[model samples]
Each structure stands twice: as structure tokens, then as C-alpha cells.
Target: MDMEIDLSNLGTVNTMFAALFSKLGVPIKTTISPTVLEEAMNGIVTVRPLPVGTSATGKVDKQCAHFFGVTISEEQAHSGIVVRVTSPAQSKFKLLYFEQEVNGGYGLALQEDSQKTGKVTSAGMYFLHFQVYRMDSTVNALAMAKDPEAAFFKRLEGLQPCEVSALKPGTHIFAVYGDNFFKPASYMIEAMCAKSYEETTERLKEIESKILAKRNDLRQFETEYRKALARFQEVTNRYTQEREAVDDMLRERDNIHCSFTTERTLVNPVGAGCSSSRYTTEHSIPESPENGSLDGRDKSGKKKWFNLNLNRSDKKA
Candidate 1:
């Protein structure tokens, strides 16, 4: 039985076989066409999850493969899907995973051009993990196997969302996972593009206002200081003038004491100048002679001579 098989239509044939074999509980081998092979080799292929027991027989693009040197098989598709990365060298992505959620948790990731928000919705206990990384650096990551909500907010404190949104080709990855042994749990994760600048501007304005207030306080302190210095100078000048006045009064008192000393010295006795006989002669007067008698005549003559001498001494005094 000869049949014409178009190589260009291999993808359709592979899909038909995959469905048929999956229902029959058997494995189907898929052939890779030239176009698909080229796309996968160039790391431009989209990798989707495959049903159990279905196999695509070809080398997958490295961008879609999670672990290096590992084969892309049906078992891997059922377990966990590898994240697609077009340019691993230049692309920025973040991963947030949570497990075993007894309590609800939250996660967020921000980049220059993209933002992600995630939350765990469960009624049971769970474990959480969140991580953020870039091509050159790991920006932030929560502690492994711990409560992701607290770690998410803690890491967020160091990041400025507005500044992150301003970077070019910025990309961020966010995820949240919850595991419940007793009951089923659900999670929601959202990724979106955004540009933020207003928050940054508001922050700058707040800082500037604080700085201005500080500057005003300094200026007020300087003005008060100048006034206080002027008051101190005025008080000092008043004290100085009062001290000078007191000094002048003391000098005048000393001069008056000296004058009294000089006057006392001039009036005090020197040598025999203050004798008793000189004092008596300068102060005493002779009695007048009585009637007319010879003795009276002699007395009268001496009295006249003494009076003449007294008149001359009075003039000399």
C-alpha cells in the first residue's frame, strides 16, 4: 500500500496521532518538520504541555528547556512545565513559588517595564517562596520554604516601583503556589506592564520640604544668636561705665584726704616757736600806774615803754 506523505503537513499528522494514541492508552511518536526544527534550534519555538504517554520525537529549543542536557519528554510535561526564555542572557524574569498553604499569602514583583502580583487562596496551611533575578544580578529573594507574604513586603521596602518602571526593556516574573494536604487550594497571579513617575516625584518633594524646614530653623537660630550677642554687649558696656564712675569718685576722695593732711602740717608747732614765754608776751598786757608818786613815775615810764614795744610787736604779728 503506497501513500503520498506531505512533509509540510507533518504537524497536523502528529497532532492526529497524539490524540488517537492518547485515547488508546499507547504512546505516539511525533516527527519534527524542517520549519519546526529550525524554529526550535533558533530558540523561537513555543513549548506547550503534552498529555501523558505522548512524545514529541525531536530536540526542543534551549529556550523552552528547563534543565540543561535533559531530554524533553512526556513525563516532564505532566510533572512541571519549563518556563520559556527567548534570550536568557539579556532577559529579566522573576519566580515566586509557594507550597502547603494553611494560611493565605501574597507576592509581588516589579521591574522597569513590567509588574506582577500574586496571591494564595486557601483555607489550609501552606509554605511559600518568592524570588527575583536579572541577567546581571539577583535583585531580591525571600527565604526558602518560609512564609512568603512577610518576605515579599520586606524585600519590597528596598525597591522603588516608580524608578523600576523607568528602566528600558524591564521585565519581572511573579508566582505564588500553595499546597494543602487535606483540602484543595487555589492561587491567582497577574503580570502587567506599567510606567510610574508620580510617586518618585512626590518622594523628592517630601525630602526637599524637610530640607527647607531645617534650613529655616538654622536661620532662625542665627537671628536669635545675633540678638543675644548684642544684648550681652550692651550689658557689658553699662557695667564698664559704672566701674569708671566709681573709680573717679575714689580718686577725688584720695585728693581731699591729701589736702587735709597738708593744712594740718602747716598749723602744727615747729622747734621752740610754740614756747610759753612767747605766747604770754604776745597775749598779756601791763596794768596802768596809780596816782602821782615817785614809784608811780618810774612805773609809768616803764609802762609807756612797754606799750610802745607791744604796739610794734602787734604790727609785726
Candidate 2:
């Protein structure tokens, strides 16, 4: 069996594979003056006037990407370097980090033509983009740009802290720009060698100790939370039982109906026949209630005087 493959469409095939494997890049549509960019390439110092890009029409370009390069010496690269950008109060700028590729495609040209064109048609041979060493992981240039103007004011108000650590021994490129339609003014750029290995080890040990302490605190908090939960459950059960007992008592009371009836009975005294100076008179007796009896009064034939008789026809002395 014979197998053959045609490589005539090699360029097309490579292009398709590149599209499938590679990430889409942000087009370099904005640029600053080559003179200012050149000055910013010097590491470990302050660059002023903020290298803002102006369009061909002389309008400030918000999309401008000011490329700043910091070349790390072989000695500095072993320890790494910390690149920090400090913007003024109430003014802000953002940084996007990129590591230059070994092929070196004339990364972000420092030419007058590129600035006047208002676009960096020249491609940069850098990758690993748009992330800072000390910035919040969630914040990036793209995310800030996507926010609405009103919603993004607070992010622009305060000082935007931008810092990055480059470990490689080469020229590391950083793109500084303004977002949310805000223009960046004067700011400072600084690059310094990272701490020594001994210092870094000490820091790691301190962090480990603090983490252990935090774990102990978390365990204590969990124990207290469990104890509180158990107490809450006990109180809830007791309250329920008490509520049921009171309800039972109320139900029993509701079942018992209480009614009152006032009936008066007329009774004549035993000495009714004797009509002397002391005459017998009629008296009234109240019927006893079903639930209770009258206050221990003598109901027998003992001479008792009562003026509650309804029959007033009988005369008394």
C-alpha cells in the first residue's frame, strides 16, 4: 500500500492550526511618541508626563498602550526585579505585563511614524500578558474597560497600585494605559531587585507560623459555634413543651362552661301561728350554685333575721 499527503496548502493549514491553538491578541491601535517611550525604557527611576498618546488629530487617545521596558541584568535576574508604577492621587493608570519572546520581533517600535499613525502596526514578540504581581487577581485591563462609565468612577478615584515581579534575565515589557475613558497624567515608574533568598525564606517561615495560629483560632471558633447551637436547641425544645402544656390547660378551661342562675325561695318562720308582739315573718333563700355552695350559713331552724323578702304583705313587729 502507498500513502501520500499533499502539502501544497501549507500556509493555509498552518494558519488554521495557529487559529485553533493560539489566543486572539489585542491589536496595538494606540501609541505614544518614540522619544518619550525611549526614555521610559530606562529601569529603576521615575518617568514623568505619563507618556500619553495623542491621535493624528491631536486628541488624547484613551486606547493608547505606552510600552515601558525594564532590562534585568544577569545578576538582577537571578534575584528577580520588582516593577512598580505609582500614579498621583485622584488620577490613575493600569499596567499590563508581557514577557518578550526569544525571537525578538522589534517589540513595540520606538519610532515617530508609529505615534503619528495613532496605531502600532508593528507586532511585539511578547506573551504572558496583562497581569500584575501585586494587583488583585480578578482585576485586569479588559475587565476595567468593560465596566460602564458611571460604575467605574470609584476604581479610577483612588491610587491604582501596580506592581510586577519579573524573574527572567531579559528586557521585560509593560504596557501602561488609561481606561474607562479617563486619561492618565504624570506618574512614576520604579524597578528594583527582589529580596535575597535568605530573607524570602524567613518571610515564608513567618507566614507558616501565622497560618498555624489562624488554624487554631478557627478550631476554637468551631467549638464555640457547636456549643451555642446545642444550647439553642435545648431552649427551643423546652419552649415548645411549655407552650403545649399551657395550650392543654387552656383547652380544659374552654371545655368547662360556667352559667349563673339567681332564684329566690320564700320561707315562713316556724312561729307563724303565734301573733304576739314578736310576729313571724317571711324570708328569702337563694338557690345554691352547681359548682359551689353558699358561705357556711345555718339553713336549719335557728332564728335568723333577713330583710330580703319579696312578699312584703306580712307584717312584722
- In order, candidate lDDTs are 0.33, 0.40
Candidate 1 lDDT, 1-317, residue by residue in tens: 11322323446566466445434533222222344334433544333332222322222231122111112233332222222212212221222321212232212222121122232211110111111222211133323115453343333233322212121221212222111111222222222111122354355447645654554566566577668979999999999999999988876666555444312333423222222132222445555446455788998799899999999999999
TM-score of each: 0.20, 0.35
Model 1 residue runs over 4 Å out of place are 1-212, 262-317
Candidate 2 positional error at 263, Å: 14
lDDT of 2 by residue, 1-317 (tens): 11211222236665345334322432122234344334444332232222211111112234344555666667766654544444433222344454343443223321111111122111111111222212121233344457553224323222222333235666656555442123433334555554444465356447645655664576566577668979999999999999999987765554332111132224323333222233235567776743344533554212244433433436552
Best by TM-score: 2
Each model's total of backbone clashes: 14, 0
After the best TM-score superposition of candidate 1, give how far the Cα of residue 188 lies from its true spot, in angstroms. Answer: 43
